[model samples]
Target: MKNKTGRYSAYIRPFSYFIDLAIINLFAILLLSENVYSIYFVVFSSLSWVIIALNVEFYEVYRYTKIIAIGNKILKQFALFTIICFAYFGIFSNHSNARETLIYTLLTLLVVAFAKIFIYYFLRKYRRLSGLNYRKVVLLGSAKQVKQLASFFNDNPDYGYHLIKIFSTDIDKKLAIEMCCEFTEKEEIDEVYCSLFDLSNLQVNELVNFAEDNNKIIKFLPDNKNYFARNLKVDYYGYIPILSLHKTILHDPLTKLFKRAFDIFFALITIIFLLSWLTPLLAILIKLESKGPVFFKQGRPGIDEKEFFCYKFRSMRINATTEKEASKNDPRVTKIGKFIRKTSLDEMPQFLNVLIGDMSVVGPRPHLWSQNKVYGNKIKKYMVRHFVKPGITGLAQVRGYRGEIETDVDMVNRIKYDVYYIKNWSIILDLKIIFLTVFNIFKGEEKAY
Candidate 1:
């Protein structure tokens, strides 16, 4: 079910990286050989270029990336790199000439930028003329926007998206969707372009699940009314805009690494400083109050809808209604449960879940598997929250969507916030949610029963 790429296409970026490094070091040695510490300059410049490139996403140029975007990246990388080069000499007290350093930086960046632009256009021309490196894409829906998108794909072969088939939703909707999925699976389709206006919410959900399960890329053609939807990356094919479902900043490998590192660090601190002693005290209270274990583990879906046992302090006495959410004055709540739930102390044990890598320190809070099944069918895009690891505390919880869901509106609003958080996630946003959560714990939320 894996999507296939051209034989040498995958190596292009890595080759570009190697070539850029060579250019940088070669220029440094050639232009700054007068300095005794030329080797240091080479290493410093090489590392700086890579780090800067990652931050600026310099190598993220794709077939869909515009020339203007490439130029912008080049200018950004050059500016930042120029700063790094000058700072190195200032810090190390190297006697390299200022003019020579400027020349080296300029020549190195020019060559790298030229190589990047050349590859970008070369791929475009190659795809158009040689008919290689093209993705086998299926278009679904019969909306006007979808028609325009199909036309764009047909007109611009240089973009490397081969329009395999178009399944019109104007006919029998269910049959069309089924046929689309079947064809996609049979043909080894690389991507599916769906029009939001043509498909129902449930149908869209099914497509999303199918794409996830089958390892196919799914994008949406947002209608004119919903063009400004949040949490999706919009890519322009000429004047037409297409929305990508999984293009969030979190989708970046480096970004995921940073978030995972942060999660581990934060989980360890909480476990060592808070939970280590707190768990023993909490366990004694729970045992005295009830006859069951101190910790309660409930099956919940994590990232990709995979089942994992979510950990929490035993907040409820052993009851037949463990799957049911606790209301304001539910009979299942133990005396200790009331206090822990109010103070948000019951969720502290989930640091273990975070440490174990089944969850995150900050993300959409995992719900009961039963609740997920119900709401996932009831609400549109409700399951999108599972795209990231469920969290102990989340944007929805901090925004007062925590605890019992009394109405469908409550869950709908919660899903909105969850989607927004996923789309707009940043390290700073995670910190803000943590801060707001702490504030809510003390200030007392009305629904934190």
Candidate 2:
């Protein structure tokens, strides 16, 4: 099996989806242009499918390649797409060309469903039979453990572990030589899975050097399976391999979706009901004491490092944006600014940012673009915080890592909490943070500033 064949087979899943969406989209315009919004409609729907599908491990090529399984996948994708499709349709249901009945839309959905299944399976079979796919892989651990693994491999041939040979990292060179001899002189193997735990701290560096010095691929079979799965991201493009500790949204998609939806809904409620009254009151107070705008808008980075304007009540004296960050007992803060800073009323307008998807009701708070520039240069992996949308309030804030950062220790700890939130993100965790925030808001603290 050649690298090209293996690469094509690995890519078939995503390719099938691209073709399927392309076909359904083409059919929508050709067949139902009168009622359906076909052009931008297809664009949004397809993009969502691609991102969400990839997130959900839909493209991961495991051993299962049955037609029944493929059919199930098509059905699942259609069901999810239907949810997106209906949401879009409902938003514009009042449009002149909207579908008359949900039933008609569902029928067309079924047609697209079958079309996708056909394309997916056709590609799978073609790749399985014709694609010269050779997966570069190594079995980890020693002869005993690998023999156990080999037994497992014998059971699951479709796994495609191209076992090259066994490599051992025994503390005693005599043991290593004997074991390597047994495996080489006796059994068939492709590559080795090394156990660093077998080596002393001093020898660990040498073993790593030896493995790196060789061109052979190395697989580390750590004792902790869950830890390995959680930490390792191994991506291979043909013979090229890359590893990283990256996150996929599928690990917690429902939570992420719920968080965003709640942000929008709560933000909408704030603007529609509370803002009308509060804004006027705040506006009068702000205008009486300050020459600046009633609402201050500043650019901040959001999810995936996209920039968005964040809104807040005018808390400080005019032209205070560039001079310094807001601080406790700062003379630059106006009477209204001082009160709002303590009470956190200044942050209310950011709810609008939540509604518009620029921020969340609860996430790591976005820093000033200037602050981001300052800290990002100083801190390692600081920008990973922007992997999700910034928020109105966050665990760091509620946990008292808020207000002025007087030291590097504070900023580092703040980032630590932020990354912790991102990695362990869940609806339950978010709900806890929201509850804590409301508790802090009413209980009130000087640090709220």
Candidate 3:
């Protein structure tokens, strides 16, 4: 009694990747010369892309994730593909045309990236709006987490889970068991999500046996106490298993190295190409407009709540009193300051902060020391953003959560985006934020003062 529609679930992603790479190789052959080594190039590139993508679980769609997350996974897989191509061409190949080979690789990757984006969004919308394909799912047992899961399924039809029935402790135990068995026996339910915290071992065994006998998938929902354990990896040491949540993706050694490399590369380009002329010009403007230093250097919290000097082009008249947060049409903003702040050119000097390793090009933006203390006490998990170095522009800023915290709702929403950024850190996400930031600057965000 195998499931009919999802039977080929495992093959879908691999098949797509295979087709994409095949097209890329065919194009490369038609565009470039058809050398004897072309076959080897296709084989190596396809294998590398598939292997790396599988290792990263890049194709496994998480039901709760956003489309941006899917795009992030695609870009990360392509990044790995680019690396493998580099290794093959630079280290192993005897060809003198390494640059040309890299160019072909880049073009292929770009094509596949666009293809993945279309497939991901288009298929999701088709499935949701057309109501074409959906998995029949049932909930078992009772817990707060179970309700949360149910709410999520109801809210996101794009996830393709159709809830049929819920059997919980509120119902008679015997009747609940009977209904569960009946559901499985009829082959009406494709999967069962059971919360085991309150269930007896016998009850759990009964549910498991019924699911196995009916060829239905079973997933266990952790207790509400473990709600915060979203992204932790489980590991086994010999026979004993361990649940560890201390490490996050951004804190991984390889991830840190890769992000640091990107930060340096981006910072160097900005400094040499754009900032070299812009900084001197802005410095003179600030000097002529205001009676303070060219740069406003203030202490702000960085990773792990450590203090760092955050630099920005001075965008306000020197205030001897308490530095209150900027308001709409604040008189403290100088003429030059208003233009720089509105254009976000004031944040340009933070590239120096990025270059010096005090900050990143993208992460949670650091707040002033006073604001940090105030928000730390007011908001839950406010300090979690400190897990990674602060950035010049961040998820919250690009998402239009920047500027003065007019109310508690603003602060809370800002923290929510910050926490999300920390949990879902990726190079592609960083690049997306940077792209949005540029667009926002040009469009002129309403909050910009």
Candidate 3 or 2, higher TM-score = 2
Task: For candidate 3, write residues 1-449 as lDDT tens digits.
Answer: 12254422445565776768786677668654444246677788776766676677676664444667667887788778767776876665665366666677678767777777677677668668976567788877664636776776777777677888887756576677678768754755767876656566587667655554333556666544553354434432222222323456887645876898899999999999999999899989989877889998887878756678888898898896434777889988999999999999998999999998999999888887787757764676686777789999999998889988899999889889988998888788988999999999988899999
- Which candidate model has the greater lDDT, 1 or 2? 1
**Tens-digit per-residue lDDT, 262-303, candidate 1:** 999999999999998999999999999989999899888787
Candidate 2 C-alpha lDDT tens digits along 223-338 = 43343455455543222232333454523545565666677777888798888899999999999987878988877777655567889998887663543677777777888788
How much lDDT does candidate 1 score? 0.85
RMSD of each: 8.3, 12.1, 18.1
Candidates sorted on TM-score, descending: 1, 2, 3
Each prediction's TM-score against the native?
A: 0.58, 0.55, 0.49
Evaluated at residue 154, the lDDT of candidate 2 is 48
Off by over 4 Å in 3: 1-243, 321-323
Candidate 1 vs 3: which has more TM-score: 1
Q: Could you tally the backbone clashes for each prediction? A: 0, 10, 0
Local distance difference test scores for all models: 0.85, 0.63, 0.74
lDDT of 1 at 184: 91
